[model samples]
Target: MGEWIQSIADTYKAICAGEAPWVALGNFMNAWYDYAKDQREALVSESLPALATSSLEQRRWAAFCVASVEYLCQRYGLHCPDWVYQSQYSLVEPWFHAVNPHKPQVRARLIETTPEPFTRRNIYCGNKMFANKYEFAAQAGTTSPNQAI
Candidate 1:
């Protein structure tokens, strides 16, 4: 998880606490860059500062990331990959939580999964490889390298 991801948990807490507009424009821009996924990088890079100030505005931008997910997908059509459900949505979801941490009607969601445990089997390769050439010849009862005994 990213620092921003951790901060989203914090942001959720803050939003629940009734603080006004805890989100910043930089947060929106970073999330948008992730959402845009290279298609809007240069634009976000150049346009972010203009949108970065004011807590209310920042909060609104973050909310939009959540609110207009379907609309944006429709607007971009095939250009937007399915990754919006992955990283892009993830990056913005915290802001959505921040915006509506206390919304009882809405169920805030985040993906929490446990990875499968890794067990090393035969951890070394040499034992699995074929035996040496001489050992094979000796095992076959061959006295000469080219002739069978």
Candidate 2:
């Protein structure tokens, strides 16, 4: 398998092994921005479908994975795969990706700022939850893609 595919598979494995969805997604995004265009395309077309279809005991995690992948695809201007839109990939109840201590305020903020890609799948997170990694790296004075990675 290609390196990018392996990277995505590793992210899936990490999620299955009980890693936080946001953490796994952050790691995946860190690597994703460094991959070549064709490699990124390969991941969008191949790895994401496999991840979306994989059976997991935790329905919420499964939904989060699908939503995250769809969100990434949309952010990068890739055509989101049809399988991502399947009803099974959407959460029955909305998931707010924030600490529980400030429930009402967090929910209100998420409702206002969560991007459409995540909201469509009933996964609500901060607006900048999946911002372009490369842009952030550049802002932090990392001149090289490899440096960011």
Best by lDDT: 2
lDDT of 2: 0.67
TM-scores for all candidates: the values are: 0.22, 0.73
> After superposition, which runs of candidate 2 have C-alpha atoms over 4 Å from their true positions?
4-10, 36-38, 47-57, 139-141, 144-149
* Residue-level lDDT for 102 in candidate 1: 51
What overall lDDT goes with each candidate model?
A: 0.32, 0.67
The alpha-carbon lDDT assigned to residue 97 of candidate 1 equals: 32
In the range 39-63, model 1's lDDT, one tens digit per residue, is 4322222211222334553544333
Which residue pairs show backbone clashes in model 2?
none
Candidate 1 backbone collisions, by pair: none
Q: Residue 59 error for model 1, in Å?
A: 14
lDDT of 1: 0.32
Cα lDDT for residue 126, candidate 1: 17
